[model samples]
Target: MSTDQFTFTVSKTDGTARTGEIRMPRGVIRTPAFMPVGTAGTVKAMYPDQVKALGADVVLGNTYHLMLRPGAERVAQLGGLHQFMNWPYPILTDSGGFQVMSLAALRKIDETGVTFQSHIDGSTHVMTPERSIEIQGLLGSDIQMQLDECVKLPCSDDVAEKAMRLSLRWAERCKVAFGDQPGKAMFGIVQGGAVEALRIESAIQLAALDLKGYAIGGLAVGEPQDVMLRMIETVEPHLPKTKPRYLMGVGTPDDIVEAVRRGVDMFDCVMPTRAGRHGQVFTRHGRLNMRNARHAEDTRPLDAESKCAASNAYSRAYLHHLVRSNEILGMMLLTWNNLAYYQELMAGLRKAISEGRLADHIAEVKEGWAKGERDGVVEPIDDKAIAAED
Candidate 1:
């Protein structure tokens, strides 16, 4: 596992949807992978072991939260993020630029860096490209993102252009500060709001740096789903085909499918875990809300067809009870179920792409979601039946 030898290999391609593998020192992440967010060094209510058991190839760590809470220096002192979190798998750390701009107050942006108060305790901190790189390095991230300004959606062209240009300049600084390493890779993020021309400029400029990977940032903030998908299409063709394309902080199940169709290979979002805590569970037959009174006395699992034991073994009635009673296990079980659904979706996608049946598979998924579950029914599909179908 030579660090310098990190690579992505496309095994199959159907249209723009591809089934590939990203080889890293810790493990090989399957392309079109949905990385569960592990902000603050935990995937909220989940042990790292359980996360891995859900077939997660990699997990994302937040530089902003980690730096604010445990401090990057403290993590490094304890033997890097992998050891600090007790997860011996690949970890990708964001630059903290997005969080600082979006989550912090009184943010002052300058050519040098961004100054803002920590959302946690209102302490002041400045993050430069160099500092962002340094923090990620200390965290020992396998994939480190470049620090880039994330502009709010619906900004004027002039404002968007300035931020895009500044982000490109910062990308250069990030590259210089990132230096070089064997197994570790630094990625450059393209920021241009919603303008195609600025997006092209950002993509072309970042492409010139030739980072290990490229990520499209700043669109998912408040833009419409179609707008985000269109922006991705605008930038995808200009990016190097050999390097992986990542869409930052993106999306729902439908959003993921659309982005992959446009050639994105990686994604990270807090939707699954966050929504899980709030009683939303992703299933083959659309989203299920455990808080609904309809689920009371239901003996069926969240998804009888799910490969995950948690999804198939636990009754909806029990889960609903746990959630209504504010039991911690409710959050845990539902989070696991949601992640399992995501992984299952990814697997279906990969299989579809490989077999040149992505369109049909996607149609089936949409149809299943539309059909949903029968009300007041606990018709759990047996594991044997699901296995036979597969």
Candidate 2:
């Protein structure tokens, strides 16, 4: 466990599924890892210690947001993102390419880079691959992504090919800009929309650069789950087996399970935290709407078996009241619960993969979700309490 250099070791594999460790100087990331999105230096409503306690080995920092606000230079001056955010574990950073592309109307892309108006202040900025790498460096990212154009799916093959080629070019620039970093990595992103040939070609080309790792981008961005899986299948075959594979911006629990089955090693998404803020919570029994009236009189905890306090200690009735009343604590509790569940799922995946029973584990997990919440007797609301409130 001496991790002075960046390394990825697959400890076990079940068919295409894998269990592994990505050893960085800062810490070790368990493969099939789900990095909670900590965009703008925070994972929304949870504390850094809580995020770590929930079993996340790494958290994702948003290059676009961090570079725009607080500024990369400022973060570096403030002793990098780990010190700035107080999360000392591994921090992976996106290249800011997706956020730039998301600003479709406000941005223009060229061979050089993306020139766009900032969403925060409408100020103009340009992001080249080299600058993206530079920004990630300033943030002290352990795992940094290459700047690549991620086109929305269902586009023409011609458009897909164009973007894929452009991304390949950008990948080269990012690699060169990243230079030599002992315990850090700059991952190349595979982008080809839904075109199989383009995806294969992109993967093959990026694998040639032989970056520290690879990420499958341009997926889960409005594409059907089947299509996304198809893209993963196509790209996974062409990429180097020894390197880690990350599927970016993916997804629900089902999506993670499917992608892991197809050989993805790392993942990041905003679904869990975002869903929590909206009064939704994901559990072993699937997603539940805490805002629903059905939970108004339920005394049952979200999951009594869960090690998460929010899930085991709080009653559905109380959670329902908090969410309905729009209390901030409800958002924090639900967010914590969701992240805990996701990490638990990841731990399960690693164990199942090691045991050579990933398929069985996935089936059981899906079954629990399909079975939904168990039926429970509702506790009667006290009439005197209700009368007093009225």
The number of the candidate with the highest TM-score is 2
The lDDT of model 1 is: 0.87
- Candidate 1, residue 168: Cα displacement in angstroms equals 0.3
Off by over 4 Å in 2: 373-390
* Model 2, residue 13: C-alpha shift (Å): 0.7
Q: Residue 29 in candidate 2 has what lDDT?
A: 94
Q: Write the per-residue lDDT of candidate 1 for residues 1-390, one digit (tens) a residue.
A: 424467888899889778898897888888889999998888988889988988898999988888888999999999999999998989999999888987887789999999999887899999999999999988989999999999899999999999999999999999999887767789999988899999999999999998999999997777889899889989988999898989998778989988888889999888888877877788887777788888899899988888898799999999999999999999899999988899888888888888998889899988787677543232332323322220
Flag clash pairs in model 1.
3-182, 3-183, 4-182
* Cα lDDT of model 2 by residue, 1-390, tens digit: 538899999999999999999998999999989999998999999999999999999999989989988999999999999999999899999999988888534998899999999887899999999999999999998999999998887899999999999999999999999999999999999988898998899999999898989999998777789999988988888989899999998888989999999999999998888888878888888778887899999999999999999999999999999999999999999999999999999999999999999999999998887677453322232323322210
State in Å the error of residue 154, model 2.
1.7
Q: List where candidate 1 sits over 4 angstroms from the true fold.
A: 1-4, 373-390
Local accuracy by lDDT, each model: 0.87, 0.90
In TM-score terms, candidate 2 sits at: 0.95
| Deviation (Å) of 193 in candidate 2 | 0.7
Q: Candidate 2: what lDDT?
A: 0.90
- Residue 247, candidate 2: Cα error in Å is 0.2
